[model samples]
Target chain A: MALGGDARVGEVVESSSTGFVSQSYRLYGAPHLGALVRTGGPCPAYGVVHEVATRGIDPSRRPTARGEGEASEEDVYRSNPQLEHLLRTDFRAVIVGHASEGGTLYHLPPSPPPIYAFVHVCVADELSAFSASTDCLRLLAGSGIAALEEVVAAFLRHAVAAQPDPQAFLAGAGRQLAALIPGDFRTVESILLRAAP
Target chain B: MTYRESSGRYLGVVVGGSMTRGVDVRLSPDCPVEEMALGQHVVIQGQSRRFYGVITDIALEWSDDSIRANPPDTSNPLIAGVVATSAAYAMLRVLPMLAIEGEFAMLDGPAPARTVPPHFAPVRLASEEDVQVVFGAEDSRHFWVGNPLDMETRVCLDLEEFVTRSNGVFGKSGTGKSFLTRILLAGILQKSAAVNLVFDMESEYGWMGTSEGTGMVKGIKQLFPSRVGVFSLDEDHSRRRGVSPDYLLRVGYNQIEPGDIDLLRENLGLSEVAADAAYSLARHYGQERWVRSFLDVSGPEMRELAADLNVNERALSTLHNRLSRFRRYDFMTERESDESVEEILRYLDRGIHVVLEFGRHRHDLSAYMLVANLLTRRIHERYVRRKEEAMGDASREPRPLVITIEEAHRFLSREVASQTTFGNIAREMRKYNVTLLVVDQRPSGIDEEVMSQLGTKLVCLLDNERDVDAVTAGTYGARELRSVLSRLDSKQQSLVFGHSVPIPVVLRVRDYGTAESYRELGFLEASEMRRQMERDADDLFGGRD
Candidate 1:
């Protein structure tokens, strides 16, 4: 059951135990990067928005620049209404934890979410409960994505804003990151610098 | 983080180590490492018992080499906090001293720690209650000498146990040796059943002693006037000091035995042949009159006298020159004086302590050795006889005597220990009810047997390696205690161990030279002092007042 104003951002197009990929219904309508988004099912899997993209629905077709003489970017899309149906917004979420019978568990879910599962952007209250403990940072840091540093920093910046005590949470997250990434102070320092409240 | 109070606060956990090497403790990060001090008493909670120990060493350690190569920025509180707890930590080496089973089992007191606490045993600072259970409370038999390092609890010495065997007071010069000796003597006088016969070589222990802070403080005699009898050898010097000593002493040349000469070999510069000839001369003229007879011969007849005595002429010449030194001492006379040994014996028989003052002869080692040896030999003989008689009738036993001698190395050195009566008293160890309180700076010069036999030793700062070794020799945990003993502050602090204390402890010696110290030891004002004298007399010889 989605709460008031909980955006129904996407539907799961691909799924696995570690993560899942979702496609938004409307073109260019995916949640912003690093946002906490959840899959809807009997057992919902939660993740951080690690990667997002917009591409043509057909594999052989490539989307090209069509706004050279347009007054604004909106005119190009409005002139060709068919572009909305031809393009798709999809995102890959790194699974940080899942909702269980007891509460949010900062660990991998036992099974993947069903394909085409509805994915919604999590509310501030729901995000606070998941980020209560920094244990989930280990999962995010070990995801092995090229943009891991930026993803962690951006996710912490969003999570810390929803926390009751932002400074304490930032410091706690900093120590958690410092310990999770062994001997890699440059990465930890860079993440801490950007995530600092 | 919460601040932990040090009074019995949980310090750390015993990590690893053995009995001989002592145990190592890894301090918790929350407990500040700076608060850990050397020689601080700590208690370890073991499986079924508790062990007591002292902190011997402290260290900083880490798990990863990368942390050291590229140190983390600890300027951030969170970074510093996490690093201190996870990667780096403080460690301590604690030498366990005593152990006890169950909390109330202290009635038998703590026994020497034979085994170490199991790994990961919780350790904490010894609370006041724990300290009290270890060091008994001060009472009539237990004298409060001072407080243990950095603690308010009293460290008491069982004076009765102290006097049962010979004890020693040792330190380098100006390390408060005299003041420490004075405190022990005052305690013996006030509390113990033993009577003291102090060979006051420095003349400081008789009427007064000077402290660096206090101008002049009262001595044992001044505190226990009626119970103490000050005997000076120089009547003129005694009068000048306004002492009016109870007895004035003068030893006759006949009292100088060959054994006394053997102890003064270095002081008199006597050759072996010369020193041995004194004995043969005694055999020729009899021991009672040999010294006077040998010194009376004219220079021209010296060779003929040597021929008649069957001694080398040159050795006889050396003997005569050395014997002449007795004549120059105003306290030595042509005829024996009753005021010397007889009066000292009378004072001892009545349970009055005798302080034999050297007066102007303090620096004269020859004079000090001669008089001390001569009187102590006679006293030892009387005690041996009285002790034999007491076997039949216990009432006839003389009061136990504690003979205090300063510069004791000169008397009890390995070369001359057998020839001196002081050494015999040290070895005999209350066999005839007499023991020694040897006071010296160079304990290394003293015989090993004598140092090993001293029942209790109060040692001050002695930076000399051998002296420190000699003082702590043959005791449990001597090796581990070396660092604590060496690092003591130069004054007022002392390391005490042996029979009197249950465990070895470093303490700040209680005040000795202040007027307040005198009052604390029961010294009285002038009017009350007179009444106290009368009261002591009444207690000793039955009331006459």
Candidate 2:
């Protein structure tokens, strides 16, 4: 069962086609070619819904040439059992994206499909999930974006410590890495609030 | 790193690929190395988790317990397999620090490799303080310095080492026994101003010319003159013409008793007795020339006069024969004179170390007797002079002269005791500081008393057990001394025991680097001989033509 639109935990839904399956778990975002692999099934099936309107909404904002070129085939390979284990576990969320500023992607050994990455976001409040996930996703892209958030959050909390601005610090570093590939940001608001200084 | 103390010893953790860091364990001595079975890897220690180190000392260790406990009935696969496995690993590892890790790291880095430290440090047996105390403050007597087995030992000997008394060097031929002997001699010559007289019968020391050419020849020849003195036994006849009749009689004849005079009379002819009576009468008349003047007369006429007196011709002839040398001396002494003889005697009295080089001459007993007689006489005169001076309440400086006789066993016989005057001189000369450096291949052949009196002895590599035992018998420190002598390799090891050197040291002599000099000398002599041969050949052919 799957949901076509965004979701709230309490909402109940049904799949377009189902036979004794669990309640529809709604998950949709930009770059709409997303996937949902049912891990525990006898013959686990991986469904990739390549939405026809995805390219039209964000065609110009594709991943950089380097990101598309140097990416490993493992990024596309999905492991259902591993995904099922993480999804059914106590872990709030798992992110299989760029780990630090240099843009090295981190995939757990039981990887999920490439289209919808695993982003782990453990936030106190669910309302701020979207903003926090976006910031955390950006952080996974580069040192510059992550460092900037650290500075902004530090100021907001009146934790204005004697430290340089992160973006300026990254610029001062001179060298740059290729841009990061995009990932789902459903829990960004909560991630951003939790990661605030 | 975590460490634990076990059996009162600390054991360190095994970090990375290294051995236990803080362990202090060594191989136990109780277990004999020979008993270790093959193919058995004994666990020495476990440093970290899952990291174990083992040592397989032998192959038999890997055999089945039952098979190992019982003797093998036959050559079986079970034993063979274990032996093969054990051979693969037998290295002992202590710690990473002790391992060759540092050397390998240095090799991997950017630099050339060199040497590792030696297991033993070179040191001499004696020290400088010992040297100062034993040899006195006078630096001249430090003969053992630079005389040890190596350069480091030389430095130590030079700075240290002491000798309380004189020393001796003995060895077999070509075993560097002579070379080491020379080293001690050379060292003495360098350190002390004390006089040394070397009797180089083999002509070895004569080559101590200048260290100009190269190799062993690299020495200061200015130590003495190149051509010191040469006494050819072959030329003794011509030499005798210059000595006085009294000296000739002393060497050629021994004193006779009155009983021999009666025997001489009985053997003489009546006519010979008459001739001797007339000659005696002329000598009584103070006509020394007239005694021999009758020899110009006819033999028959002289016999007629002798017949009238009833003198025996042969007995008279013997007296005339005896008087002939006196007449010959009278004629010869008038021209050459005895002043030079007196002068030589005086010069000898002043104590000059003279070399009597009898070059390439086969032994001549007469020449030996003459030279020996002269030397003995001079020495005796000096001894008397010293005795007289002491008795007369006069004081004089002591003269300690050592006479070295190379190949001495040739002249001084062990079987001949003090029979000859020379033999007696050899026996008694020790008291007058007249020490004899008796060198020979056969030390056993020399007079035992002479050998025994020589307080210092240097024994080089001896091929003959008898010779080694004989030389060793007279030495102190017999255990180390005996071992050193028996173990000496030909031309390498030398056993030096004496008052000159402290204890007996087996030394490997350094080459004097005089090979080039010797080669040059050899080459020049060979070319000269060749040229002379060619000239002789040409001369012979031209004369035939």
Candidate 3:
């Protein structure tokens, strides 16, 4: 993909996803992106704004892989000039976490030019944790956009976790999901994917 | 000559007087003198004449009645009681002579004692000149009646004083009290332009106050409003227990004093808590916009409301029903927040005495106190709202209203006494330019504090010794009042006293030719209900067959 380059030492654009996260948290429920990452798959992930880091991985440095995913020597690094292009844009990413015998490890993938069906689990997990408490429920109900966002994030986490995935950590974690958030799983999936990282 | 040795000493007599026929010789030594009784008569020659009539002026020896009683036998023992007992005995006199008579002649010892002569002069009815001395021209205008009016002059039970501040009439039953009251009331209403409000219990004044051929042709309810301003206390008009609903509760009750509260409890058989609760509920209801709807509430419902507020349920309900009935009277419409005195002025000017007549009603203390209180309040409200006559209405043109309560003792009873608002107003209304004309057979039934507040006193002939005593003692000194009340004849005769008249004068009150006298005469041999029936018959038949 053609990436626009700029100063390599510039500060990363801090995404306002936290504002979105709080809004969406009020609007919907907890952030679903975190759960989506921990239980990886082409799951729908949603969060409002966690922090955004735009200084891309140095291309010259050696890459390291941790957790259950196979360690590979792939050149997944991008230059600072390319990072500028992504920094100026929305910070959308597929967050994946691998847990195994050694310990739990986290992986964040490069943002899709247009979001794809990658592991969108990290945002989903965080959204789930925030929506669990009653105070949060009340906050979500009264917080307007924040309430809607909280609800949306919670739904996304539940949706992604419900997906059939052989490698999903929470596979068969509970009873079969009767319905997804917004009362329509397919519609929610399409909307999440359309707005995905 | 045989009378010389008699133990009876020589008593001086009229000598050489022009009226004296002759003088006689005396037997004993000169005797000490004593005063003579006024108007006592002595005889000389054959005719009897008063001592003063016998002698114009002279020094005469006299003795006590005790001495005369034990006169020594000078004539024959059988004639000891005889010999004409000297034909003239000087008697003691306490009072001075008002008029001059003939002259005295010097006579011998043992003059005969004096006797009162019955002068056969024809009795003269009281004349206006006799009343004028006590009642000046301005007040004499209000005086009515004739005959022996002079009797009223001395005691000064001055009723004119009662008329000024206005007076009250009170008494026990059948004292000719009401009859006596009508005489003065009819006089005042006819002769003066002063307005009167008669609370005619038993529909007593309706016949007279009505504007038919009944003579009050200029009465307001006829001339101006033509409404049924007069209300009846008939069962149809008054509320019965459990049968009638309370209007006060419906419209809202005002603040009640503690004495009134006690009366409500005692009279209405309410507990203290209940009375208090009912009172509070009434006050609350008064402030609410939906107050009138409360009238439609059942008695039990009302009682419950009062009970809820801890009011004497019975009292709250009963009183509420009673107040409700008044609203039905044409004169009483729903009061607007802005109803002005200017509106009521028209009615007053129409010469129709607005009788806020609460006759035969079961108001007890609450109704009397409340009504009186409301009137005073209304008057004050008007006075305060008045624009100070624009610096020209200086005559103060006092919104002349006279409140005539027939049985004032009921309202100003010693039972409620100083605790009642009526008592308060009775004392205060004078300053507010309000006059109270209280009428009752028993003035003693009323509190002395209230009775003393009256500026005018129209004393009709009262027969009840206690009633008379109380009224006379309350205002006038007991001595003179006792004399006047004792001698006062009830047949149209009353002593008008107080500031309203120049002096206390008793005269037969002038007849207004109202049906009152007829009612008084015809009221005999009839039950109250029968009397009412007769009145109704008379009204319908117009006195024709």
Interface RMSD values, listed in order for every candidate: 3.2, 31.7, 71.9
Q: Alpha-carbon error at B230 in model 2, in Å?
A: 6.3
Q: How far is candidate 2 from the true structure (C-alpha RMSD, Å)?
A: 26.8
Tell me how each candidate scores on DockQ against the true complex.
Answer: 0.25, 0.01, 0.00
The lDDT of each candidate is: 0.85, 0.35, 0.39
Q: Highest lDDT, which number?
A: 1
Total residue pair clashes for candidate 1: 0
Residues B409-440, model 1: lDDT tens digits: 99999999976888899998988999999999
Task: Please give, for residues B1-545, the per-residue lDDT of candidate 2 as tens digits.
Answer: 11221121122222222222212222222233343321111111222211111221121222123334443322533223222222111222221111112222223221211211121211111233222222233343433422333223331133112222223456666665456545544453444332344533333443442222232332222232331232222234315422111122111111121212222232232243443465453543234334435444345755664565455755555555543433332112222323323433343345433334333332432233233434444554565557556664434533444455555554455634344333454666444434455566777766677666555566667767667666777554343345446666676455555544433444555445454423322222456667877889989887444
DockQ of 1: 0.25
Q: Candidate 3 chain B: worst 10 consecutive residues by lDDT?
A: B242-251
Write one digit per residue (lDDT tens) for candidate 1, span A117-189. Answer: 8898876888887888999787898899769999999898899888999877877787677678866655666
Worst 10 residues of 1 chain B by lDDT: B1-10
- Fraction of the real A/B interface contacts present in each candidate? 0.08, 0.00, 0.00
Q: Give one digit per residue, the lDDT tens place, for model 3 in B273-356.
A: 544544465466653322354556774577567656665566666655644554553433344432323334444555455544
**lDDT minimum window of 10 residues, candidate 2 chain B:** B48-57
Clash counts per candidate, in order, are 0, 83, 117
Docking class of 2: incorrect
Residue-level lDDT tens digits of model 3 in A21-107? 111111123233322222212321222223222232454553333333434323222222243332222222222222333333222
- Which model is ahead, 1 or 3, in terms of TM-score? 1
DockQ of 3: 0.00
